[model samples]
Target: MFKIISALTLFISVSVHAQTPDSLLKPSPIKTLTTQQYNALIKGEDQYGMGLVAELNGLPSPDRALKYKKELDLSPTQVATFTKLAVELKRKKIEMGNFIVTNETKLETMFRTKKLNESDLIFYTNRYGLYQGELRNAILQASLKTWQLLSPQQVNKLLTFKKS
Candidate 1:
């Protein structure tokens, strides 16, 4: 009886102290974008931005127009008109991106090499604001186009799943 009780106690203690496998203990999966997916999404966004700008600015490029039109199931004429606007917008966006990149370096150089001044800071801030405005317009235009393409159900799904 004593030996049996000792064995039972040891068994219970060992079982109670056993560690769960790390894999089984893992938390629930979180939805997140992979690096590749993020890059693709960014590319898709630029394409969308270009499409909107071309449509709004009256300089349709077929490539830019098709990007949005294919997604939206728009007619050929609508695609053409919108593409023109998108292309123009894309051109502006490219210029803006480049300008910002260049100006960032200019600011760094001013601080590191030349010494920062009030006028330099003001100029840099103004350029940044301008770049921000251009980007904001592009994002709004793309979102508007996307909303137009998505159905009510699709929009609901998008809204529900969208992280930010």
Candidate 2:
């Protein structure tokens, strides 16, 4: 009887533990933005995770352009051009980021309040996508402008600089 009771207690404990909900499986109250996503949005950083696609494809990001300006032997005009592009990119990215985050909050509210409908859903999704594209375009266009500012030799050097 003692052994049976001990085994039953152990089984019950194990069953209870197994039935406990995992924190990972539990839904967040916000339901949309993870903590990191929220931080990036609030800080006006790239939340789309595609900010470096241009750099990965042999184009220089604005910071990178500025970083290697002297090494790339950039002309004063090129430096000025990259600076202007960087300023514009930062401005546009912040604007678009705010737009994206606002739309995302609306999306979260719709789903959270059980007010989501097909039309509203489609509208927010499309709006979010449009803003995402604009943000990416802003970054990529800056990269392209930076690339154009560099000479062919400078571009080649920038492209291969990482390997060495």
Model 1 stretches with alpha carbons more than 4 Å out: 1-72, 142-164
Q: Number of clashes in model 1?
A: 13
The 10-residue segment with the lowest total lDDT in model 1:
28-37
Off by over 4 Å in 2: 1-30
lDDT of each: 0.54, 0.78
Clashing pairs in 2: none
Query: What does candidate 2's lDDT look like per residue over 1-164, in tens digits?
Result: 99999999999999878863433444433457665565565566876656577777788876677778888888888888888888888788778867877898899888878998899999999999999888888888888888777778988888876632
The C-alpha local distance difference test score for the whole of candidate 2 amounts to: 0.78
Could you give me the TM-score of model 1 versus the true structure? 0.46
Best model number under TM-score: 2
Q: After superposition, how far is residue 154 of candidate 1 from its true place, in Å?
A: 11
